[model samples]
Target chain A: MVPTSYYIILSAALFAIGVLGVLIRRNALVVFMSVELMLNAANLVLVAFARERLSIDGQVLVFFVITVAAAEVAVGLALLVAIFRTKHTTDVDEVSTLRG
Target chain B: MESLQIPPVDLRLLTPLLIVVGWASALLLIDVFFVPNGRKKITGYLAMAGLAVAGLAGIPLWNVSGSTFSGMLVLDRYSLALTWIFLIAGALSIAVALDYLPRHEIEQGEYYPLIMFAVGGMILMAQSADLITLFLGIELLSITLYILTGFAYPRVASEEAGIKYLVLGAFAAGFFVYGIALIFGATGTTSLAGIADYLSRQPFAPQDETLFLVGASLVLIGFGFKIALVPFHMWTPDVYEGSPTPVAAFMSVGTKGAALAALLRVTLAMEAARDFWLPLLAVLAAATMIIGNLGALGQSNLKRMLAYSSIGHAGYILLGIMVAAERGAEAFLFYMLAYTLTNLGAFGVLIALEQRGEAAWSIDDFAGLYQRRPMLAVAMALFMFSLAGVPPTAGFMGKFFVFTAAYAGGLGWLVLIGVITSAIAAYYYLRVVVKMFMQEPVRDVRPELTRGLNTEILIAGVATLILGLLPTPIVLLVEQSLVALGG
Candidate 1:
């Protein structure tokens, strides 16, 4: 079995990848996927911590987080689809109508 | 190990939230069953009635004080006062929504329910004393807002705003949850009071210091995004301009107020680490003031202008938070009240004028509003002045107290920045006023505001003036509530 530190390291790596995607990706869909990656990374850390600490509250919290994240993704993807249909592009650069 | 039971529910303590949720559900049912023919007025009335009843119910909870549900939520004057603010803002938004939604042909039955649920979430947030409850409350509020932001689903701009807000909002929430996990790991608990006690007992150690500071910083980032402080505020203008006007107004006030209140609670309860968080908040306060004001200089759209202006206003409120003194919270509370009333009033007028179409939302569209409808022109003038922080209006008093609190807190330089921004803001704010009163009537105008809308505008106008002039009583009430929070 792997050490708890291994899980922590994995979570950190995933979180960094998520941040990089958010910063580097111009496509709105990819950026959104990166955000979901970050949330899942957080959940991994939470579950790892729950195991290390021997508590169910942390696990319970992960459940709630998943629920909210699903709702968020649903709404977000719907908006993205609508935007793509109108602007004919999912690139963030093309969606700058309100810029000064 | 004993399983943790669901915390005991307190019916009396939760009456305000229940009222809002109940009314929201009722409105949804009414819209679903009776309003299939697109009768939007009934939904508005039902939403207003729910908020009014909730506002009335909140009155009795004003002086009460205690922790409920095993210390997860607190019932005190601080939360109650904010409950009333959220309810009144909700009601006013609903009223304005009645006029705005139908004109745009985007009336949806789900709008009122989502708004009430959002208000309920905000109330829960204000009352939360534990990290878990706080997270839950924020999610509830944010998810509802996500839907409301894109309710005009087919509108490209609306959908874009909704997506942008969702991505950024979820990013922030991720930071918040990770922060909570770190705090729990470091302190072995998720309760705010528990963390405070744990931190107090621990001797100073380098590793412990890093853990606490990193944890706190993450949490601060989470809230900074919500309040739209400079670095995290990139989403503000797009979301504000793209969403329906009433939703934008509700979010600009309700979300900020709840987030600020929760930030205060956590910071004050964990006062042991003031050295770490306070300076960071101070820098944010200054930067947000400069960035928001400078950004607003050339915006021709009314919604985008208010969005940036509200960002600057958030900085002023943050100055009050920097003080972290007794009077600081009171000043913060008073400023929030003043800002809410003034902003809703401005949006109320915008929603009223929007009856013709989105074309009326431009600053140039207001040319010779004085000639079109004298009363609305006067009301808009007062709102603009108040927003600009001019004296003899609520906005002025709100700024006075916030700056005074910051000065008392030794944030005098930040206050100086605030004053400078206020001056810069006056230029843009007065441009609208000039367009209204000075320019020629470019197009033939018709007063399209209904009786309900006119009444809302009048109430907002009177409330702004009254709060500005006779602020002492309200100030005292907020102070009493802040003191109660401390106890």
Candidate 2:
């Protein structure tokens, strides 16, 4: 079995990549995908912790987190679709008529 | 594996949440199937009724102290008081919405129910005794708000706000969940009691300390974004400016209040880590106050200005949370109550004047408002003064308690920063007041607002003044509620 510390480190690395993706991405779709990657990274860490502890709580939390992530994706995609209808683009930079 | 026993459910403890969420979903279905599009106010009224009943249900549970859902949910004076606050905020938001939605041609049936669902999430946040429940509560609230932010379908700005909120809100959730993972790794349990037990033991191993501190910092980052703290408030002005005024108003008060309630609990449960987190939070509180007030100075749009003002208020509220050991929870609760009334009233005035599709919300739009709508102008003045923490308004008393509490806790520097920033806040808050009372009207045409809005303005004005003048009883009530926090 892979060591849990290795799994935690890998999960943290994935989470950092997700964070960078969200920060750098211009397209709303890509930013949203980055958010999903982050959630999945958390899920990975949660599952590895569950395996190491031999407890069900971490796994149960991961299940709820995934369900929530799916709901979030649904909302995000709906918002993107609506935004696309009017703006003709999915770029965050283009949607700045409200800047202060 | 041994057979598992079901956690005995507690219905009485969850009466408020069940009534609000269940009726909200029911109202959504009813609106879709039976109510005509033009008559969606029925659904809105039903949502208000559900909230009223939920508020009443909480009255009986006041002072009740226990944990349910196998220690996942807490029932106490603290949660009960916050339930009343959230319910009132929900109902007032619907009042502001009932007219604004239809007038703006965005009277979707989902708006009221979504607000209910958001309130339901806030109640959950207040009641959560475990980290999982807290994350769920936060996400549920954020997801509904993301949808609600874009409820105006054809408006490009509304859509922009929606996507912005969704992306940042989701990003925040990732931080929250991973923080939970790290805390679980360090503490070996997610329950607050377990964390308290572990932290209470002296001399933690280096690895556990790193995990615990890093985990706690990440969790605070997540909450900081939600509450619009200085370092993480990038989305606030744009989102509040673009979203419909009433939705912005509701989120301004409800989200900050709920997030702070949970933060107070987490701070208490991890009290042994005070040496690690207290100074960090105190600096955060100071920076938030300075930046929020300064940001408000440059905003000309009414909604955006209020958004900045709310950020400033978040800093003041953080002052209360910083002194959670010394009656600060009580101060925090009172400050939230006063803020909800005062801020809602201020936003109500903006909602009254914001013409459909025209964005009639500049500070100049409020010029000569006194000549046309004397009472509305006066109400706006009241909210502004209260927000400025002028004596004899709820905002004044709220600031007094929180600052005094901080001083009592020996956080003199934070209190000083709070006081100085509040003076800076007054200049901007009073700018609106000066416009309403002294300046000439930029235009003669004014939009018609509902009589219900008048009631809302009145409730807010009367409550702000009354609470300001006589804060003793409410302060006592808040003190009673924070008993569990050792206040």
Candidate 3:
């Protein structure tokens, strides 16, 4: 059986990469994908932990996360389309109309 | 397979949530099929009716206390009291939205339903006995808010705020899920009671507790963003300024109220590791107060200023979490009521003056407000004073209790910072008052006054002063409602 530490480390790396993409990406599509990646990273961690503990709760949590991620994508894309219609650009930097 | 014993389902405990959800769903359908475009105000009234029923439903359950659904939900005065606050906030929001939406010509039936769902989610947050339930509650509220924030479509700023909130909200959820994963890894359960049981029995991990602490911190980060603590508060000003006035007003109180409930739950579940979190919350609270106040100093936009003010109020509420052991939870409950009343009143005034197709939130717009609408101007002055923690208003009472509670919990330094930041906050709050009363009206920002808007402002003002001058009833209610965290 694979060691649990390896799974945890890999999940952490994936999560970090996902966050980096969100922080650095300009395009809204890429950012949305990055968020999905982060959710998947967390799902990986949950499944790995479930196996290590022989607990069903972690796997159940993975299912919930996946479901929520789908709903989030639905909303995010709808919003992106709305913004795109007005701004004609998907770049977050270009969407800046609100100023302090 | 042996027959799985079904958990004892108590329908009575769920009355408040059921009322809200059922009303919201039915109202949405009615709006789509039955209600005409010109008569959209009917939906707003219906929303208020639902919220009122929901609030009253809680009265029957005032003394009810237990966990059900395999302990996924709990019913107690703590949750019930917060539920009442959410209901009031929701109804008040609908009242403010009644005329504003139609005036702006962006009247939609969806708005009322969304607010109801959001309030329902907040109720769920307060009652949640498991992390998964809490997460669902947060998402439920967030998703509704995302739609409502952008309800003013074709307006670029509204779309921008909605998109930004959606993206950042999702990002935060990712962190929250990862945190839940880590906590489950360490403790092997997501139930608050189970976690508490695990922590109580497990010997200290010392150097090996990296996973536990990291998970806890990640969860804290998720909440920080929700509560708009300083580092995570960048989205607040933009979102509040761009979102429709009523929606922004709702989120400022509703979201913060719900998030604080969950935060209090999480804090209690991890009481065994107070050594790790106690100081962390202190630093976070202090920083949130300082930054939130200082940020509000230069804001010329009224909505933006209130956004910063809401952030600062969140910081003050954080003090409640920091000192949860010593009357802190009671203080938290009291402060939520006070803040909800005062802040909603402040925003209601803004909603009153806002014109269609133009942002009329500038301080200059408030000039000569005293001359044109003397009563309304005085109400705004009262709200500003309350927000600045001046005496004879609900905000003052809230700060008094919270700071005393924090002081008792050994947060003297944080309390001092709260004091200093609050003093700094007074300048900005007073500036609004000075502009409204002292200066001449630069723009007749006043829209045709609606009876609904007037009722909301008057209720807010009277409630603020009442909560301040005679806080005994609410205070006692809050004190009795502290049945939380297995205590």
For model 1, how does the per-residue alpha-carbon lDDT over B1-487 read when each residue is reduced to its tens digit?
9997887777788889988988788778878888765786777787888888888888888767788888888888988998888888888888878767777888877788788999999999998999889999998999899888887645667877787888889889988887887676566678888888877885756655665677678889999999999899989999998888899999999999899988988888778777778889999989999999888888888889899999999999988776757478888899999999999989888877765444466787788999988889999999999999998999999999999988888888998999999999999999989999999976665658887778778988998999999998998888888776661
> Which residue pairs collide in model 3, if any?
B367-B440, B367-B441, B368-B440, B368-B441
DockQ, prediction 3: 0.69
Our model 1 lands, by Cα RMSD against the true structure, at 2.6
lDDT of 3: 0.90
Candidate 3 on B79-171: residue-level lDDT in tens? 999999999999999999999888888888889999999999999999998999999999999999999998886677998899899888988
Better of 1 and 3 by DockQ: 3
Position B379, candidate 3: lDDT: 95
Candidate 1 similarity to native, TM-score? 0.95
lDDT of 2 by residue, A1-100 (tens): 9999898899999999999999998888898889899889989988998898898899999999999999999988888888777777445555556675
Give the Cα error of residue B138 in candidate 3, in Å.
0.2
Model 3 chain A, poorest ten-residue lDDT window?
A87-96
Q: Which residue pairs clash in candidate 1?
A: none
Error of 1 at B94 (Å): 0.4
